[model samples]
Target chain A: MTDRTPGTRSSSGYSAWRLIAEELRAEIGDGRLRAGDRLPTEAALAERFSVNRHTARQATATLAEDGLVESRRGSGTYVTGEAMRLHRIGVRTRLTKSLGEKASASGNLRVLNSAVEDAPTDIARRLALDGGKAVRIETTRSAGGQQISMSTHWFDVSRLPDIATVLRRTGSVTSALRESGVDDYVRTSTVVGARHATASEVAVLDLGQGAIVLVTEGLDSLTDGTPLQHVVTRFAAQRVRLDIEHPRAD
Target chain B: MTDRTPGTRSSSGYSAWRLIAEELRAEIGDGRLRAGDRLPTEAALAERFSVNRHTARQATATLAEDGLVESRRGSGTYVTGEAMRLHRIGVRTRLTKSLGEKASASGNLRVLNSAVEDAPTDIARRLALDGGKAVRIETTRSAGGQQISMSTHWFDVSRLPDIATVLRRTGSVTSALRESGVDDYVRTSTVVGARHATASEVAVLDLGQGAIVLVTEGLDSLTDGTPLQHVVTRFAAQRVRLDIEHPRAD
Candidate 1:
């Protein structure tokens, strides 16, 4: 009554279920499991692997833990990566447009605070400014009514004295910068990471306990690589999938 | 002695701590507070924000929860994002190099199993195979002697019967593909997300409870976007940072 896949060791190294997870993970990696594609039913996997359905569920659960797949309520497990609303990271990516259907518009952005503050050493360095005070703006953003991101921005007050007023009115950082005689800027670099939501973040983002948020600290620069802005953002990991694209090397 | 930051709301909307977090987060965003940089001491921030040390600690803790800042043992809080160890995402990125010190060579790879398996419909489609059998390979990888990633790979048996042997011998997937007549390939796109670690993953990754991992499901192509490989990789988010870069427009 001991059913197992033929021609594989069962008791030596990894268990039967882990072996299955390995294969499934490979499939996901190799593009067999595209984002948003539903995995086989537990029964189907169990029968195929000659194991019980419980073992099959274990395999999918591991994928869920890694954010590779997710189990929807009453539905089956779906490949999670790249399936959620896509947030494109690129030179000219617009904040709202990149979120696609998940985000409403810049109009929905909330300007929570604006003040003049000491430009910390690093901040002053990136902005090409000397040690001085700068304009700081704090904002929270949402997607489809769910709070998704929170950000803080700093600008050299002497360069953009009206930046706070423009940011409050437009709710768009790009527009605000443009009005200050900076015609255009592009994202120069982005470093991405993830961590658990803070207690305060949970209250704002409405996350369940142990929820993770994707953090990005990025720099924007003018065409010739003059740094203009440095921003850090926390995105609710469940609502967004980040697509990091690299251009062809000529 | 109710000292507060002058000209800001206190008893109206958010509490003082939340507003402090908001301000600090903005600093992080705008490059005032940079990744890897130590924040002001609790006493210093308390004086700066005009709040008590308890309130200041609460603000920093919120940043920590969001993975923006981290408190080290006796080392104070440091920004957690961009500084954790940069994992550069680019067309020519090498796995070991991208990880910096976090990964060793492909020599650390261990092949767990190899067998022939039916190509699931989706897997078949991405691999450009019909409904037929394919070779499956499973492997677990480590960094600095710590288990970091596990992967499964599939190849059309007819196209490369010796793939498993080649991968095992060279310990490099690119070399294996190279031996099979694929001269070169590039990462076409990548989808990045994060989630909690599973029980099995926790044991393998040696992570504390509620730890998060960065999952990337990416596609590699033969310079023409002709899909060559699809892979999902899980990285301990604490050990690595991913830099998603955008190339300049000529």
Candidate 2:
């Protein structure tokens, strides 16, 4: 039993199952156990660790509960790894382009509110507009039929006079911009931050209060460097990971 | 007085102070009120908003508690604007190079533990080590006299023997690598994620139990593209924003 046992325990005591789970978790983290790999049977794990069947079952259960594994009714448990989709943000990030096939196929946008409002002073500066007011569009974006982000966009109203109407028809800012005669845009800057979701975010994104929201404040401009849009997007942190690329540095 | 009031109150009904705070928060978020901008005086804000001084004070107090503003002795309140430092991660992210002058001058690393241990399977693969064992170093880093991050690093011992000794003398992994005859390396990939601080992270980083930690799991390779290191660093999400740049994308 001693020879078969793996992992060293420190003097500070942990439960038998917990130690087993930690060792396995490290294996998963390190890459010994990969996604879709079947875990050993309870009896085999018990025998290898010199623990009882109950402990082995508990260890696998812990891993499953943590979303590291899945147990089918007939088939044995298998590693799931992260299981979350990777969203890449590059110099030219398009929501449709960055998302995976399933997300891209099912991605939908709902305009919660759209109006020509007094542009916040900063938004005015970013959009390079003279007036205090600009067009504001609040939207909830869903992917794979689940709400993923709440985005508030500010645009210079005079430049895109019928943006709200165009956005309503297109259900996409990029498409609306294209209709407005702006063919292409690139991300100029992005400030990435995180904060607890506000009550409205909790409701809009269907997340718990205090859930982490990955906040991206970004500016996008025309290919000619004419600023076009300033957007603030709050993403459900658990559901998405923002991959930001800094192209100029390389 | 009520005629001067701004912002539409939701059905849930917020206090005058909260409405004021929200508007100010939006302004700050949009970049109207930038860092070091002195806020309007309490009397001025109360007059402009048609609210009492107490309400204005409450708004500023709320912002202060949220780390958006700071009150100095005899000096007016100013927008601190997030207060947290931005730590940029890129193809060649060096802690000293990424941090600002204050952080760079004061930043320190404390070795929590160093040992030759079974590399987590994923880390083993990242380092291209055939053997299961690797050198592990756990550390806590601080700047401006506050704990900032807890990092766990794995290195293939065969490639860089006595790394711990070199790290101890240099207090920097990059320097230790240089000492080991590896002149330079670059980040290959980074996985950015966030989760509630673990117990050990909370204790080591001096954070509340449920505080968020921004995690980056990454691998570094030599200029010639030989994998050299796998590191997992967790930053106090409230205190630092990881600015990732995709150098190759540009």
> lDDT tens digits, residues A88-108, model 2?
766677786555666553238
Q: Which of the numbered candidates is closest to the native, going by highest DockQ?
A: 1
Task: Please report, as a residue range, the 10-residue window in candidate 1 chain A with the lowest summed lDDT.
Answer: A1-10
Off by over 4 Å in 1: A1-83, B1-83, B101-105, B119-121, B132-134
TM-score per prediction, in order, is: 0.69, 0.71
- Which pairs clash inside model 1? A26-B152, A29-B230, A29-B231, A29-B232, A30-B230, A152-B26, A231-B29, A232-B29
DockQ of each: 0.25, 0.16
Error of 1 at A204 (Å): 1.3
Leading candidate by lDDT: 2
Instruction: Compute the lDDT of residue B133 as modeled in candidate 2.
Output: 74
User: Compared with the real two-chain complex, what DockQ does model 1 have?
Assistant: 0.25
Residue B32: error of model 1 in Å?
A: 11
Instruction: List lDDT for all candidates, in order.
Output: 0.71, 0.72
